[model samples]
Target: MNEQLTPRQLMILVAYFIIGTTILVVPSALAAEAKQSAWILQLAGTGSGLMLIALYVQVFKRNANSNLFQINERLFGRWIGKGISLTIALLVFVFCAQVLYYIGRFVTTQIMPDTPSEAIHVLFIITVVVGMRMGIPSIARTAEIYFPWVLLLFIFFILFIMPDIRVNQLLPAGEFESMSLVRGALQVMSYSFLPMFVTFASLNAAYDWRSSMAKAFVYGTLLSGVMLTVLVMVSTMVLGPDNTTTQLYPTYVVARKINVGNFLQRVEVIVAFLWFILIFIKLILYFDVVIMGIAETFRITKHAKTLTVPVGLLIAIFSAVVYPDYVYQQEWDNTTWVAVALLIGLAYPIALLFLSLFRKRKAAAK
Candidate 1:
């Protein structure tokens, strides 16, 4: 059971988790709101994310012996704790489905406009199920091996896109409104960073010591934050505020702009490859969490391999029907989705932390 995610492994896990679909879609989402200053909002969002990780680490320290489910049970009584655990399990399930939906959408719009979405969905699910059956150690090790390559390509893409950057495009400083920038940052924080709470389920891989937990969460969040900011920079500088806001995949557009010579045309292939790696890792992690949550819910400590298919099938079907089309998906993510994530992702863990601390104080006073 001790996959024992090293600092290196945790950092990559978190970087993948944060960057996933957001890098593809968020520039448009943020630009639609904050315009030229979206990169500045991204910077602020990263700081907000760092604070949230600090909060999560504190909860982990207080409930050192418990996984997320056990922590819920300890914080509330049996029935209520089970209820909360079930709710979280459902959230994790929906989470995987949403990520799946993004994969389908990306493939259809960005890569192969003619390919059927369901075909992509089925193929992706097959890979995810196999990864889940193999389990976290395999997943973590695979990430360890492949993450560096993705990172290198990402760095290459950023450097590749630089010559096209128009310094004047980011000027004017949101001349119309400043509040939009604040909202933009909040959206970015919720969409990208706060979801890291999902890591609570597999946190047993973290070393038992409090500092180890801190190292894993802090380093991971910081690294992912840097990646997000770099992506925003590239998107805004190259595409300009108006075009960045209107495009479906601003970063991909930036990649498409890369052309050193006629020989190097269409190297946006690197973006596609980078995204496929990152999104696949994100989907697999959430898929694994759903299985883990079920085991914790029913106390099925033994063989939950039986649970994988039902969950995977459920997610695949749900993903297909989740959002009718790209426009609605984009709207929901910017407006409703962040609110939903905040209520569950932020609400549950912080409440659990408060209750645990209160109970600890009562015990000491007695």
Candidate 2:
């Protein structure tokens, strides 16, 4: 299928992918680990993420006309490439499932305790399926429309709560160790940027090649990193490290503190609404990339129409199966799981760039 989407549409997709479930939980999660120094971790993650983008851009440039599966086949021969593609596809599918489940569980617990998580899962799957069926351009256009409102709500809530910020709460009073900071940076990097590896696989299908993608990746990562930094800083400055660690959603807690003149309380609803929109866009973008990957792998014509419902359903079911409960998932994410993500998102791409360079040299010699 040669259905081409516009650069604007692709940019929207990229933006949505860059700011999804991570934004909702990462600030509080990383704050628990790194305390007031969490912003440093976020900054480090953004710098490292840019390096990963460079590697992805190299791969995309080298195989500009091919999807990831095709590129792998060309680079590593048919069988090895198929194995690599299958492994990547499976990993991405698992990641998508986890994202869906996390969002569903979060909405049920935080917003509507009476509503079952399964219902939220179904609703989310339906929306994703509809968006995927509509095609990438439609999904991208929808993201562009919703993104501004989400950003406005985010900015307004952040501004409204600024008066409550207590700067002393973030004072680096405790003894700091460089090793601990490095570990914290690694953890935060895993949480923030590692999941984005799934999207790079489909970059060949994206329009405008290097400039558009490089711009989107750089600006979007910076934008998200800045927002997340502000969120962590505000949480630290308002709640203190101990209270920030105890709270499930410290950013939401900060929003709850937004009581301008005693009339502006209960702003958490606005925060929750924005979270829903941002996460929904993120999930849809991931769904789009996974669908495209499947199509390219199988060389299917009109893959979008045929795969949308099935993939969405699979994600819903897989989401429930991925973790026994939210606590287990949280533990997994904090420790070994996130480390694995960093390896794939950062380490693997860098390795690929080196491998590609070696291949090019050998071909030139011949």
Q: Which has the greatest lDDT? A: 1
Please write out the lDDT profile of model 2 over residues 1-366, one tens digit for every residue.
335555555555555566667666777766766787777766766677677666676766766767667777777788887777767777778877888888877788788999987788889889878867776667677777887887788789778978988887777744456766666666656765666665656656654664466676667777777777787888888888888878887787888788989887887888888777778777776776677667767768365578888888899989888877978988888776776787777776676667678888999999
Q: Taking the tens digit of each residue's C-alpha lDDT, what string does model 1 give over 75-107?
A: 898778888778777887887888888888888
TM-score, per-candidate, Cα-based: 0.94, 0.92
The residue ranges of model 1 lying beyond 4 angstroms of the native Cα positions read 174-176
lDDT of 1: 0.78
State each candidate's clash count: 0, 0
* Pairs in clash, predicted candidate 1: none
CA lDDT, every model vs. true structure: 0.78, 0.73
TM match of model 1 to true structure: 0.94
What are the runs in model 2 whose C-alpha is more than 4 Å off? 1-12, 173-175
